[model samples]
Target: MTLTTVLLLGVAAVLVGFAKTAIGGVGSIAIAIFALVLPTKESTAAILLLLLIGDVVAVWHYRRDADLVMLRRLIPAVLPGLALGALFLAWVDDTTLRRCIGVLLLVLAAMQLLLRWRSPDTTRIGESRPAAIGTGVAAGFATMTANAAGPVMTLYLVAQGVEKRRFLGTAALFFFGVNLCKVPFSLGLGLFDGETLWRTLALAPLVLLGTWIGLHTARRLSQTRFDQAVLAATVVSALALVVR
Candidate 1:
């Protein structure tokens, strides 16, 4: 890697590490950065690997609070969506995928905003099979395409009235499973070669540092503040993706 790319990756790594704990969605910025500096397809694989590391940290921090029942409910729907996404990855054009993600984020954000307005005191809509399936499908497709699953899943979990720690735990575990499953396929696609692995190894420490900062910040905020921060960060990052 060029010095410039290394530097960029380092910076993006820290933000993503922080995002893993603070907002969850900012990892996409790292995805974008890698895609810009490296091959888009290859970067997809590398980012997934880094995200797996982040997922480990997230799960470790939030393990005791996970909502296992809800996790079980969502898995059936999420599995089919992930299969569809993996299929999409086999043929989807990079530009089309990016725009699709940008559009999806905007739509999800608007819907979430409308929902919040409709019930000012409520943080999440009632849990329903249909909603879980819908968001799970969307998240699966988006995550496979652009590593942008955070926002879609965020809306779904937040709507389910998940408490703070449980929400993070569930999200962390969900992504951990998804990304872990993705590893073999990503390698099959020739996205994770020796060079990328070496680079990721070189940058691994940044991931740890960023996660540390993010978790520390995460622990300081109230539940409401944490949720709001996640939402706000999602919206901002979504907009940034569109403009880029």
Candidate 2:
């Protein structure tokens, strides 16, 4: 890889960690970076590894705060989504995957913005079975296809009115589980080769550093400002992929 690519990936690793611990949607920016620098399929595999690393830290920190019931409800729904995503990955070329990822990111960002605008009340959305299933499916497919599920998951959790720590905890565990599940599919798709593994190892420390930074930053910013900053950056990055 060029030095620029390496540097960008390092930055993305940090973003992965930060997103795991601080703001879930920030990881979408990392996804955009990976897709920009690497082949789309390879980028998905590479980021999944980094995300798992970050997930370890976030899960350990917020392990006790998760809503087990919600997780249980979502798991069944995620499986079908995962299957669908894996099939899509198996069929698409890099350019198609890249554009698809960009579009998905834009859609997810829009959903988040709309959710924020329409209501603060979580009860109606959170309690609906259909909503939970839809979120699970969407998250599973997004993660499997592009490693871009952070925004989708974040939108769901926010709609459910998950508190900050609980949100981090639930998201951490959820991604870890789904990502682990994705491993076999990724392997079958030949997404993980030696170079990708080595690159991930080299960049792992940045994820830890970002996690530390996120831990500090999480309590400082108001949710509105945080969402605005992350969403703006993600939209720009996503747009680049679409236009490229």
Candidate 3:
């Protein structure tokens, strides 16, 4: 890779770490940056390792804060979603799926925001069976297809009235497991090779550093600002996918 591409990927690598440790909705920026820097297929695999590294750090710190029951509800739906995403990899072009996913993210975020605004005291919207199934399936498909599940999970967790720390911890653990499971599929697709592996190894340290910074950032921020920031980032990132 050229020096400029390396620099860009390096920055993206840091963002991956930061998003995993401190926040939820900002990962789409890393996803977009990686796609911009590398070939599309290679970018996803390369970013995957970076994400796992960050996940390890975040999960290590937040292991005690996860909502086990909510996770149990969300986990079952992901298998079917992953299978569908793999099917998409086989027969569907990226452009088609990108458009569909962008629209889905946008709609979901809008609906969640509207619901929260209209009924500030109620968490039932996200806690319902239908919402659980729908968000879980969407998250799995988005993550599998594009490594872009953060916003969906963010909206769901926020809607459930999960506090910020719990949200970060739960998301960190959730993606950590999902990302690990994706390894065999990615290898089968031939998305990672010697060169990409070396690149990922080189960037791993930066991911750790970013996670350190993120932990401090998260600790210092207030809940209201954190929630607002995540919501804003999620919507903007979703729209970027559509506009691009």
Worst 10 residues of 3 by lDDT: 90-99
Sorted by lDDT, highest first, which candidate order results?
Answer: 3, 2, 1
lDDT for 126 (candidate 2) = 69
Q: Which digits, one per residue and each the tens of the lDDT, describe model 2 over residues 55-171? A: 899889989988888899888989898899999998999899778877877876677667667885755876689988988898888788988777777667766666677777788
lDDT values of the candidates? 0.77, 0.82, 0.83
Best by lDDT: 3
Model 2 Cα shift for residue 237 (angstroms)? 5.4
Per-candidate TM-score against the hidden true structure: 0.92, 0.91, 0.95
Count of clashes, each model:
1, 0, 0
Q: What TM-score would candidate 1 get against the native?
A: 0.92
Instruction: Please report how far candidate 3 places residue 133 from its true position, in Å.
Output: 1.2
What stretches of model 2 exceed 4 Å from their correct place? 223-241
Clashing pairs in 2: none
Residue pairs with backbone atoms closer than 3 Å in model 3 (clashes) = none
Q: How would you encode candidate 1's per-residue C-alpha lDDT over 1-244 as one tens digit per residue?
A: 6889779999988877787766776776777787678665667777777787788898898888777777776777766776777787788877666666777888887887788778864443547777777877787777777788888888777676677778888888888887776677676766777887887787778998999998888779898887787788678777766766
